[model samples]
Target: MPEAALPEPVRKRGRYRRRLRSRIIVSFVLLGFCLTALFAFATNWARQRVENQLVEDVMNRNLDASWQSYARSGGADVMAPVQQMRAFLIRPDMPDRLNSLRRDFPEWERLQDGIHNISGEDADGKPFSYKVGVRKTPDAWFFIAYDMSQALRGEQQLKRALFFSVIVFSLLSLVLGWWSASRVMRPVSDLAARLRAYRGGNAHPEPLAPRFPDDEVGQLAEALDDYSSRLTEVVQRDREFNADVSHELRTPLAVIRGATELLLARPGLDEKVLQRLQRIQRAEQQCTDLIGSLLLLSRNERGQGSSNVARVAEQLLESHRAQLGGKPLELELEGERDLVVDAPEAALSVALGNLIGNAVKYSQEGRVLVRVGAGMVEVIDTGPGLSEKDAASLFQRGYRGTHAGYSQGGGIGLSIVSRLCTLYGWQVSIRPGDERGVIATLTFTPG
Candidate 1:
């Protein structure tokens, strides 16, 4: 059977069976079916018992009457009963109670060996059963036959009663089910309305209404409300953080941009001015890198969008290789297949770029081998690497190690990578460089 349509209450109360009416309906149907089956069994048992007793009574009576008749008349023909009609031999009350004379019922007559027979009705008034055939003495007989109109009438009454009961209870169940469903659905509908207001196209966590504090439905509402309210608080905190990022980054960028512009504006300014411009430009780049890392952190927090991991990684590696400027990054791809992950392509690029860039920046100008494991990316640089202190918190948001050296980014690169990896179920770990510099590995998100 097709499933019943979900009631409005279940939609509000829960995604499935959460209404009192649903439970009651299910329980009632099961109970009704079981009771009906049991009733049928009991009725059948009683009916069969009564039928057996009735048959036994008739058999005994026939045996008694036949023995008496035979003892009195040696082998006399059985008497013709009431109505005296020609349509039947033993009219009116045929010798239905006697077995031997049973064959002649509705048309009975004694036969040889003191036995006779007659026909009778089935449960449904259809002619289907045969009456008894019995011997009264060594050579005398009697028989009986009749219709089952009484049994048929009783069965008909039972069927009608069962039908009426089902109709009445079915209607009763529907009314009860509907009312119970509404009662269960009330709080849920109210909660949903409140949720729409709270979410407001964003995660605006709102506290639950305090009116109902301890009921089951109330508990659910309170939990959802608490979550929404927490969401709003978190959003506020993030806004503050993003604003702080902007304020912290503007000063250095302004200084570097202004210094570079002033010297470049005046054509052919001297060699000393040109050299100063280079340092300013480098500082400006570092400030931009720092700001970028902070922005990447926000994107990772929000799960902004998706990206093609394999394509993005390949592109970033190609760009980083060019910057090697003669020192090669020995590349090793562990698998023949490409790996895909649902993440921001730019964040992946920036993260991988930072690890490789750091390797190049800190190394003693040597080869930085990059290895892509089955589920990870490893960057091993040739430089005098970190101590235990540095490795412990190397990927902390702002903590830089003693040997981290001054890099373009303000220490947020590895942190962003770590945060993103955590959020997307990836793994990230680092150890001292392979007898050279740093070796950082980021396990890609499992597909």
Candidate 2:
């Protein structure tokens, strides 16, 4: 069968089952990554803020101490306060000191009374960074430079470490997500497997709740158990009812058959009366065949036999002819006469009978042809042409077609035919005929 012929619900179900587990795993991995990345960003920001505050405080305090020492010494002291600190002093009367300051720190003359950051290469062509603190009095000006090269190197090292930590933690998150996904999905997978095992119709299936703990999965299992119990009860009751009905119906049909046979045996029976009696016999036989086929369907079992397709078609056409009366319809049988099918006579009769009956019932005039070929049969009718709505839903139980006005049927005949085809591994299709009416084809060897 072509994929385009499959029902919409079947295709949607296939897509959903394939993606569910993978979607769960992908969700977990994404959540882990987002949380880890957020933490890394916060940690880096806080470290940079605290380190800048501490460096500024130390530079301010040292500048104040150096100016106080020079004031106490009566403007004569010129020594540095710390190993990483350099002090420079200039007075208005000292021309030589001003000239020396200009040659060494040219940009420092315009400094205000606060710390400022500066970086550049020295005379040795090596890169250096420092914080310069300025203090000015009416008598003298003092400048303190604090070297920050060591602190800059330490900050670079800390950044490198944090980068590696981020990589390591992200990888850890990936592994944790994978493990957690497996653990979470195990119970769901097990439940699905158990349900699949019970699909072949177990007489008494094992309880699922007992195998799982008292959680969400356990609740689901318990609910399934309740539903299964109710379904099993319903199916059993239906089977019993069908068996009882078939038995009761056969008794009356058998009596009718016996009465008709005895009447036909009489020597002086009138022609008209004999024809009526034979019609009664044929009706009884048709009812018997229908009951047997329905029983097999209810039991979901297949019957075994080999039947000649041409012979069955001819018999069906003859039966329909007797019922036609004054109707202007022609019934014909054509194609291969020796084609055989591997199915019971009653099953074949019920299936083909429904097709031929529908053709005769719907067509007002022209020919109803039954063509038998190798492994297949086609019932062509000059009935009112099929509509799209009828073609789509004709085989559904209780669905009457748009043109089925006043027809004496509950619409289950075609439904039964569809089930029989499924049980026997056969294929059936209906379409509009070439010029007019409908054509229904049934293939035994569909593969």
Candidate 3:
């Protein structure tokens, strides 16, 4: 289907539903979330590194302090006191005890002076984790163990808290993102509202740049002001041009009509000359109707004039009947009566005339029917059946059909009809008829 067939309200609703505000909000939210998540990750990593360094430093200090205490006591007592730490003394001469140490940690007695995590159990048969250190003294060796289970458990708790913090802050980012988007979009929305409210022709639009901040939105407002000024000027010029042309053309057309009437009024005129004069009068009348319709279109206004749809169809059929040349064709008007429309007679005449004219032109030997009833008028033509290309682009301006070979038309007749239908809130569609013809429908709101 053509876009012109879609109701205006539906198109407007579709455009509104796809507003940029929602997209802007979503973009802001995603950006905030990504930055916050990255910051949280970096913070957690740095904290973990500092915590590990502090734990190692504390272990080394405890080892050094206990070693000094044992040396001061002259190695008399092998046990050195330390909080949350256990010290062991091993001699090279004690075979059974050293073998027991070897069984527990074969490499403990030969270890160097650095911290190492070891798995073990306390005397109470509870599993424990410890950071152990080994030192060589003058008389014997010392093994110092620092219980690390508490510290490891505290680290786990901190990890849980950090993960929870990431979640909380991410949620906060979402709220902040929504607020920022609203603030950013408010100016744009106001500008759009102002533009939509301004009507042309007599009312001037207010200057928008002064009301907005000095940013991208302000620049857009300034651009819109300039465009509005230029567009208004152009529209004014077009209105003046149309008025002048319509006036100039009408004067000559009126003279021709008057002269043709006088020639017809003369007594004892030739039948051939009378026929030519009558044709000239009809042409003059048609030119006047065309002028009125064009002026109305140029002004983009709809006027209310009650006209019977069937009566107009009948008159149009009569006009086409006279111009059929010698073709064996039949013109008929059918369907219900009193189907009035709320539009000017020239509007209806131009709209219906083009359709009937096209039917009479292409059709050679079959009946052309105009069916009028209710809120619709259907023009059925047994012309060369419409091709797919023609049916799709028929009403487009300057688009001639494949069967329009050598025809005396500029191909804007249907385009004008379509424009009139649009201006009057009416709908028009042209399609290939069932079996062997074409159908053009003009549907109007019921009067």
Candidate 4:
């Protein structure tokens, strides 16, 4: 079925049943990952900045010390200031040593008073990185190189450790989220389970608030208990009212039935009086059937019996025939007679009676055909065809058709029929006839 064609409550339920705990877990995981990622980025940035400043400072100091030592010794002492450092000096007067230094370190001849970073393969084809500080003087140029291979390795290990820490914390967050969600949802889940357990019977269920702590869940449970109590009271009162009304109305109807029967049995009575008495008896019977059906509807229960569709339709047609008075409306029953319904005669009577009554009431000079089939009965009327709005909402309570102007009815008969059909698992629908009037079908075998 199309989703738009589904009932409102069903559509709402389909849209809103997502799991809350799963949402909580996903939220925690994302939060953990983002926080850890930001922390790792900040830590790596700070470490890089501090390490570069410290290494540059040490290189500059060592280069200055080497320059001073070489100048004081008149370009004699060529040793580097730090153990992990190498120094080289080149003089403008010594062409042999200058040529050798230029050949050995071709890229470092453009010496200025600053620290520079260099990284490349060495003579042995091994990768090397260093910070080089240069000092230019009138006597010579000094170059001091500080090896950075060990620091580079340590930074790589730290980066690996940070990456693993992020992963570990993210996993820990996931586990913590799962545990927290479970703890938070436990009472709500229990409340739902207990509510589900109280599904069908038990008008007065156990109090849910007492079983939970004084928290949000407990408050919800308390509200539910209050609502349930009020709802139960309302339902109980409605059932009592229906029972009382049925009992009270049946007494007068029974009296009328007895009086009508007595009058009907009298011999040689006036034809008009006899017909009136018979009509009165049928009216009483109809009132009784309507009351029984309404009572069943109010209680939302189905009465059990075997009802012959043809017989009930025929009786309804006959009753409507008498009520038609001088109107030129012809009532007829057609089709199969073997169709039986697993519903009480009163329910069937009320359902079919409303259809036939509506047909008789609406048609002025045409026929009303009640056709019985395998698992369905159709009441076809040759009255003015119903409008689109009428056909759509004909069975809604208090809804009168457009053609029902000045009609002596409150528009509840068809609604009762609809409720009866629902209680008995039947389907009822009304539509415009092929040429004129309306066709109302009641199907006992609903899909």
lDDT score, candidate 4: 0.85
- Model 1: lDDT of residue 90: 30
lDDT at residue 87 of model 2 (Cα atoms): 80
Tens digit of per-residue lDDT, candidate 3, span 1-447:
232232234366556743676676677667766776677678778876786687567666766766776677775554535566777776666677688889877767667878777767767998778778777766677777777788778777877876777677667767876787678888987887887777664646678999999899999999998998898789889989999999999999989998998899999999989877887887787778778888899899886687889998898898777777889999999997889888878889899999998999889889999998678999998988887778768878998889988989999999999889889988888878888778888899733
Order by lDDT, highest first: 4, 2, 3, 1
Q: What's the C-alpha lDDT at position 102 in model 4?
A: 76
Give one digit per residue, the lDDT tens place, for model 4 in 83-162. Answer: 98888777888898788877876778875679988899989999889888888878788888888999999999999999
lDDT of 1 by residue, 83-167 (tens): 2111112323334534433542424443432222344664587754333434433343344333344565776787677666666
Sequence-dependent TM-score of model 2: 0.78
Model 4 reaches what TM-score against the true structure? 0.79
Backbone clashes in model 3, listed as residue pairs: none
Q: Model 1 Cα RMSD, Å? A: 12.9
C-alpha root-mean-square deviation, each candidate: 12.9, 4.7, 4.7, 4.4
Model 2 misplacement above 4 A: 1-24, 56-167, 199-202
* Poorest 10 consecutive residues by lDDT, candidate 2: 1-10
**Can you give the TM-score per candidate against the true fold?**
0.46, 0.78, 0.79, 0.79
lDDT of 4 at 151: 92
Better of 1 and 3 by TM-score: 3
